[model samples]
Target: MTPTDPFPRVFIGFDPREDVAVNVLTDSMQRHASAPVQIAQIRLSQLRSVYTRPHNPLQSTEFSFSRFLVPWLCGYEGWALFIDADMLCLGDLAELWALRDDRYAVQVVKHQHDCESGTKFQGMPQTPYRRKNWSSVMLFNCGRCKALTPQVVNTASGLELHQFQWLEDGEIGELPPQWNVLVGVQDVPEDARILHYTLGGPWFDDCQTMPRSELWTQARQALNHPLALQASS
Candidate 1:
């Protein structure tokens, strides 16, 4: 936690060269978080001895590993939650953090869509290769999971990450579905809080999906609060 109360510092990865994604994330942080949201933007470095691979196949993020490593570099020694920019938070967030337990360095819950429909990853049946929960979001314990980072980095470098073939081991628990609701408009319930654009983004100026837009609105409420954006110093 930064000296500003108990709120964990939040970080996002971006290249200022691309302003739109950075702007989208910056706007979301202020709109959603209960406390001050700290945003960090990292540029690829020429520094030597960088972690080049991933330990867990699931965590091989093209741009996210470096972002995930920032807190550690700053001497932070607690757990950190990493979310996709497309994710929007609804309801109180403390519950997710409180769900952390001793055995797992992370907590994940089965995906609701896959869990209920019996349809599996990519809308297929569950098999040995596919995880019920496709990683839209994740939480990590710096103290407990730090050892896994080097391995994650290694696997990242070992393979062609551009294809996004890596994912973390499934042993970690799933985050509740409430934290990762997708853009299911017209058919979804009224209280759904998050709207993950798992398949398509509403960013297109010509987007015409109302249900998806409603979902985006909900996400913006949590992630794009106008007040929160103005509060950033």
Candidate 2:
């Protein structure tokens, strides 16, 4: 499908528990985006009608399964980007938006993530699965991803959706790892485009010491600065 909007559409997964994370992420994206972006929050509260799946124990966030509805939400046309609210955009989002390719159903940073068995933010179980963290950041070619209809997203198992079972191996395109750099878990580079606080971000008291967490702190400070607030007003 052809894009109707000139700007990129970004849908961020928002969990009420991490309100600050989402706000900081949005501010960071706007600060760094070269062009205006259509950003929307995929909060489960607003999607109860479309997403009627029973809660799974392993589900860590409100948008865990709701994120799959990105294609359906776009009316199965054009393209859109979905990202976790816990991320902090460090580079221009236009660069990531430009990487969108219609030839594939979706593009993602395919991380070989094997998180240790334990707990994460809010003491959620740190369950690991195949293609872990892949769904955290996705470039969805909506038209080609017709298989992710609302019905499918509501009923499919966690693995079926996260592992891209609906699409062939070739349909899953790869993005540069830097685009979804895993904080704490990976040796983050100085120029990481997107920082994924997969384990937990500095927002939590316990995660204040996580590597590279100072970046998030700086972003939060910049977001609330008097000058920044005055400029936005």
Candidate 3:
């Protein structure tokens, strides 16, 4: 399919607290994507039937486990991408879209980050779990991820999905690290494709000085978010 084809879908998590971050990320994607991208923000609060049930012990201030529902959300069709809300796209997503491999159930940047020292935004413990932050960005081969049904996402332990316990490690594929570059932990090359603000984001007052914060500010300005514009001033 063409990069501009309406086939490859993208799903991003949304939290009310980071509302502006989500908007800026979306704007960046739309601006650089070659095709008419189909994007959806997975809002936990709006998913009554799904979120109301107790899923797992894993904690998150944002969409949390809702990300695992991507394959099911897309009706298990073709490939779909899922990214955290606190991310900025600097390159055409179509490049990543073009890398979809039918051989694996899912593909992600294989991160070996050891972020045990810091806490997530608002003081949530940054517990270092297995395959940590790997799922922060993913390309789900929906047809291949048949195990991720609505029931599975609703009941599976956080470890089960995040660690990819369902499939053999061999079933997972790797993408270029540039596709999910962590803000401070990684050396972001001049041509990094995607910048992930894993620690926190400029939306939080203290994160204004973090790596790539300036880029995020520019993206926000491009989107014309009033609060971010005023904050930048």
lDDT of each: 0.48, 0.90, 0.84
Comparing 2 with 3 on lDDT, the higher-scoring candidate is 2
How do the residues 1-233 of candidate 2 rate in per-residue lDDT, one tens digit apiece? 24574687999999888899999999999999888988999988888788899989888898999999999999998889999998999999888888877789999999999877789887888988899999999999989999998899989989999999999999999999999999888899887999999888899887888888889999999976464445555
Candidate 2 lDDT for residue 130: 91
Candidate 2 colliding pairs: none
Query: What local lDDT score does residue 144 receive in model 3, on the 0 to 100 scale?
Result: 84
Q: Looking at candidate 1, what is the lDDT of residue 187? A: 43
Candidate 1 local lDDT, 114-189, one digit each (tens)? 3332332223232222333344455655565554454454454423221124335543666656666666422444
* Per-model TM-score versus the true fold: 0.59, 0.94, 0.90
The global Cα lDDT (0 to 1) of model 1 is 0.48
What lDDT score goes with residue 166 in model 3?
78
Which portions of model 2 miss their true places by more than 4 Å? 1-5, 227-233
Q: Which prediction has the highest lDDT against the true structure? A: 2
| RMSD, candidate 1, Å | 8.2
Best by TM-score: 2
Candidate 3 lDDT, 1-233, residue by residue in tens? 53433455899998888899999999999999887678999987677776654644347555778898888887887789999999999988888888887789999999997756456766766778778888999999888888987788778887887899878899899999889999888788998988998888899987888887999999988875355445554
